[model samples]
Target chain A: MHDRRSFLKLGAGAAVGGIAAALPSAVSATECASNIKWDETRDVIVVGSGFAGLSSALNAKRQGLGSILVLEKMQVIGGNSAINGGWLAIPKNPIQLAQGINDDSPEELVKDQIISGRGMQNTDMLRQIANRALDAYQLCIDTGVKFREGFNQQVGGHNKARAIRTLHGVGGDITTKLYEAGKKEGVEYRLQHYVEDFIMDGQEIVGLKVRQNYRFPDLKTGKTIYIKANKAVILAHGGFSRNLVLRELVDPALDKTLDCTNALGATGEVTLTAMAHGAFPVHMSFIQTGHWGSPDEGGFGWSNALLSIGFHKGISVNVLDGKRFMNERADRKTCSDAIMKNRHPDGSPAYPVVFFNHDDHIGAEEVTRAVRDQIAWKVDSLEQLAKQFNIPLAPLKQTVAEYNKQVPQRIDPLFGRMMDTAVELKPPFIVSRIWPKVHYCMGGLKTDLGARVLHSQTLAPMKNLYAVGEATGGTHGGTRLSSTACLECLTMGIIVAETIKSDMQA
Target chain B: MMKTLLLTLVVATLFTGAANAGDLVKMKGSTQGRSNHEFIYQDGCKGCHQGSGKQNATDAACVECHGEITSIPVDESKLAIPEAHPHKSLHYNQGASCLACHGEHEKKAPVCAECHRTWFKEM
Candidate 1:
């Protein structure tokens, strides 16, 4: 590894430093731990309780790790995993093999990912995930996560239909299943325990200092405790899509008005902590924001079903002129950019794009939920719907007429939308006006293919420190394809576990 | 200036045990809860708090103790209502802030009750 570089220069904010640097002002900031007692000791400690964290802890326990600890900052265990849309993009998956679907390979998945990432991603990292897609998928099986069989859907950024999902649709089910599995395997969890500092023995990572019984945003409320790790320390705490200060350090354009799709604890404090101990922070500003989030709801509230259904099958119109300005079936980034680019003359979100579809075109339950949640607008006539949203009636009628005229040709000449049938927009239109919200941070700490956090310039591993999940960057370079994180998380989880196990055995 | 100063990972971490809490190391507040956690509210309180108003118990405090209300539930998951009812909650998981919706001494009302009183039988 090369000499260490400072954190990403995303914006003009304070470079969020490490745990050792975090405390001197707040409490005791001394690295003079030689005189200090080793109050507690453990074989391995994994931070954050998301998919990465649980998988790390599980792998450690399975590999004869007798003394392993999992730490969570929030009152709850699961981070965004419990709330995410349970979609995973995997190549050459068992379900596909069972269905006799050939023409899939690690090379193909890597190609699609690099294409989506614009070649800025870690090809080696992407290659590993694609290659071990089955091994990682097997981890889900060993943990007893029952994925929905015979159910596969294509999303933005993939050249193939290799996505799979759990039968228990909500991320909560996976979180609960992993939590239970970990518990059953004797994996213990300590809630409200936030890791604040890394205890170092010269250049090596020994363990970490923590704040016990911590509450979110209540900075000065918890008590400090230090522990030692004899084997290694792994970070799987996820990203900081919600940590505006740290995010602003990388992405200066982040204003207060934008919303986040993460849980309250998705704020990135761990990345800074890892960096403090000689890890390189990369792609700090490359945050992933999507156009489907509704301003009407907060958190990652469940309108995703409508957004997915409506974005493809529906026509989005400018609220002012009632015209379709973007391809309804464009990729996620394009769809979001089109909505953000076309604005009103007054500099506000002009023509607040409205996605509308006939009743027969979308899922009834999803539509009903959207309507009940007050996110979707329901109306019987095109004129009535335009009136309901204050849209110009004449242009809407013309747009619909033109859309129906183009439907029979089985082609979207305007937007190049890929569809089997160009279904005509009929009466009783269900519409939802959507906008962009911060979803995931594609950039994070830099790491190697083995999931070891590395020194950016030197390109050397930080000895015993491993970073995984969204916390480690280089998997998705420019833009992440939908359903890819699930595969990435599981794959890295296995790699880190196996690497540590072999190292320990040696 | 940053190059001159040594960088240590700002994040903090502590581990007693995860799957096995092997030999758990207790921190300063590990044994404690929110604000004077030693004085069990269930034991009725010390003095001034027993009467009412701002000095009394809160919904946030209640959820702090009974954080796993969803798994156990209030109506169905409750082992015994008289005590568990005080710990029962219906809206904590749906992004409703525990402090925002459940206030006790300030007002004996749940904020979710304003819009969703009809939704929950407990309300």
Candidate 2:
């Protein structure tokens, strides 16, 4: 690997002759003065105050990094982690410590993660995350974030009730707790500043050129500031779930289709920035898909009403000409792809609708009051409902009759419905209009076990560059397990911080 | 009789001039709607616009100057609001404002489906 000091010298030369040189002399003088504001140069500079960045900072501090600086882009700290349902799936965690749930070994966790990855996961990275997961889970508890006990249940792949969920609701609560802890520990947080690009010393990254927003009495302006680092720079800037260009570049099929619950700033610019700096991107085709809902009057897609109804274990069918096309019991991704494939004979995109009976609706309503409040349109007769939705009445009637006649039980023989609930037998049947939409991006900048971003060509560490959270790739492998995204952010954040601390000590 | 006629003419001229000037001021005031005025006044819009409050006093007064405004009705039963996608929970309580997420100058609602097609289909 290239030496870090030589890299800084080369960067200084490039800065002098490049864009920094073209600026008006007055502006250049300000930047020079800003660079001198480094109170203490630490071994690592963590970029982002979200879960990953905070975790890295805390770990680095624990590991004895001389000083650490956390730079955040938003006005607040906690990134996306602050906005999520804080469920960290640590198979055997403190709840197990408190309630005596059976212990789960790292090997078993790794095996499950591998299976969930469906053959495309990076084994090395998955192994590292699984091995260190328990420790990370305990770290949150020790730091005063409370977790709910005994409600652990299986979702999607894992066999055990290993999901260690935060009592703080989801992401927001956990992030708040972490933020308070970080503050108490004296982690310097710089908010409302965006890291634009890395300062390169030849092939090694030495620091970052950040743009700070200046709010004046009559004007709002952004001024570029430089931050120099002595150890490493960790990127925790989240994913490209909202970036259409990046999504299209990763998978053309997913272009113009994905729906993200992510914040408006959840663009994959940081990943692109890393790629530009010679970091290789991996698994760009792995897009996560699941149920999503749209407003009836129409504008944007909202949360999946199905999940809101606690129908996670049920089957879903894509009906065309009043018949099922794919297996309802199929996994989320498979079901989404099947629904997208359902088209009319004329090759036009078919409006495949999802059907659930009264029982399913009730179950959903019970789980979430919001779902109950939204059940406004319902009808007893299929013919009348068909007219309302503009579907052919005769075809819909015939399809429901055929479906009702064939099965001895409520379980749809053609498509396996998980719970075997009865069909719409009573009055007031419900149907939701659904079409395949883009959901999540599983591809990003490739990082190693320690969450350090690597040089694309050399496979060596870029002197002061690190990546964590969704911006970094490797943990998900081919496909991601549900709820693991939040877990990865917490676990990897800690790992990167510890690594930076150890590096500084060495 | 000539003096009386002259007095009438003078009164008429002054009234006509005042009416013409008032029309211009009313037009400027109506350009800002009630919500806009409230936002401006509450958010220190007067700090820059100077005398906007006196010009557009009430919501109706603001609408009068701005012309007719169409509002998307909140269908309490729908999971997602029909066209506006107003965060129903937040909006129903009047706890939030349109200007909070959408800037005050926006004349059209954001095309959420252009990027989020799964959630939005051209109706």
- Candidate achieving the largest lDDT: 1
In TM-score terms, candidate 1 sits at: 0.75
- lDDT by residue (A36-72, candidate 2, tens digit) is 4433455577877667777878777777775778876
What DockQ, between 0 and 1, does each candidate earn?
A: 0.05, 0.04
TM-score of each: 0.75, 0.70
What fraction of the correct interface contacts does each predicted structure contain?
0.00, 0.00
lDDT of each: 0.67, 0.57
Tens-digit lDDT string for candidate 1 (A258-326): 667777678777787666666898778888886777766655664567877776667788787777878
Candidate 1 residue-pair clash tally: 39
DockQ of 2: 0.04
